[model samples]
Target: MKEYNTVFPNLIDDRYFFQDISIDKLPIMDKYNGMINVSAYTDAAEYINAQDVTFYGAWLLNMLEERLIALENYLVYDVEKPELVSYTNTEPTGVPVGYCWT
Candidate 1:
């Protein structure tokens, strides 16, 4: 019997720094007579304010930007080298491997 050890790094740990907001606490709109009232919008504003949605949203955006920058910096690939080489067909009846119709 053999045992393997594996470790995975957390990428979005900062996302969990903020407490989770409940969906039930969010505002619910009323659609009476096929129209929504201004009170629904006001309730939504209140909900947003109470949950600090804007602040967390901005934080998430910043985190995403940082992660993207890190990924771009970490990637090191040779642009001069061909990634895929086309295989020539030697058989008379079959299509060649890595052949493109266009």
Candidate 2:
């Protein structure tokens, strides 16, 4: 069950093996009939898929159940509270020495 469209980026599943984006297909043929063996493309789609899961609305409900359980274990510990720092929000800070230092 495969479909082609302009927005394939918006329709990828993460839990299954995607042969098209696997290590065997790492090398791609360019427009000039040249083979480019790029390492990043091999797993790039998987990383992007993970990012999508992280940012998807209520996606945490699907993924964070384990993390929530792990966090619950720490609830029993009486950790010391860290000091809260305050700062003025009038402008953006951390400008470089010369580039857009205004």
Candidate 3:
């Protein structure tokens, strides 16, 4: 199902994905082109979607594009096999043939 006007820092299923702010959980800033309305904290629609909301907000769209690229390349861990058995426990820990726990 398609959810409308939703946003999250990371997937809810992630073990370490922490929810930042309640305001961030909703698409309140989306109406303002993803600007943080410090003045009008109640109604997001009250905030104008101007580019010059702030020096950072002014370039938010550009920043977001860059951020998405970084996120796409984010690595929780090495996808390929890692060297885990460093002489301490070289025996197989029941992992896949080429997998190791770090």
> Model 2 — TM-score against the truth?
0.19
Which ten-residue region of model 1 has the weakest summed lDDT? 1-10
Q: Model 2 over residues 20-63: C-alpha lDDT tens digits? A: 33333333222112311355642544443433122222343534
TM-score of each: 0.27, 0.19, 0.23
What lDDT score belongs to each candidate, Candidate 1 first? 0.41, 0.36, 0.41
In each prediction, how many residue pairs overlap at the backbone (N, C-alpha, C within less than 3 A)? 0, 0, 0
Residues 1-102, candidate 1: write the lDDT tens digits: 111111213343333344544465333222221233445654544544454333344445655666666555545432243334344555334446654433
What are the root-mean-square deviations of the candidates from the true structure over C-alphas?
13.7, 18.6, 13.5
Tens digit per residue, CA lDDT, model 3, 11-97: 422222224435543454365544344545334334543322332232355555655654555543323546654454456556666
Task: List the candidate 1 regions with Cα displacement exceeding 4 Å.
Answer: 1-20, 23-55, 77-102
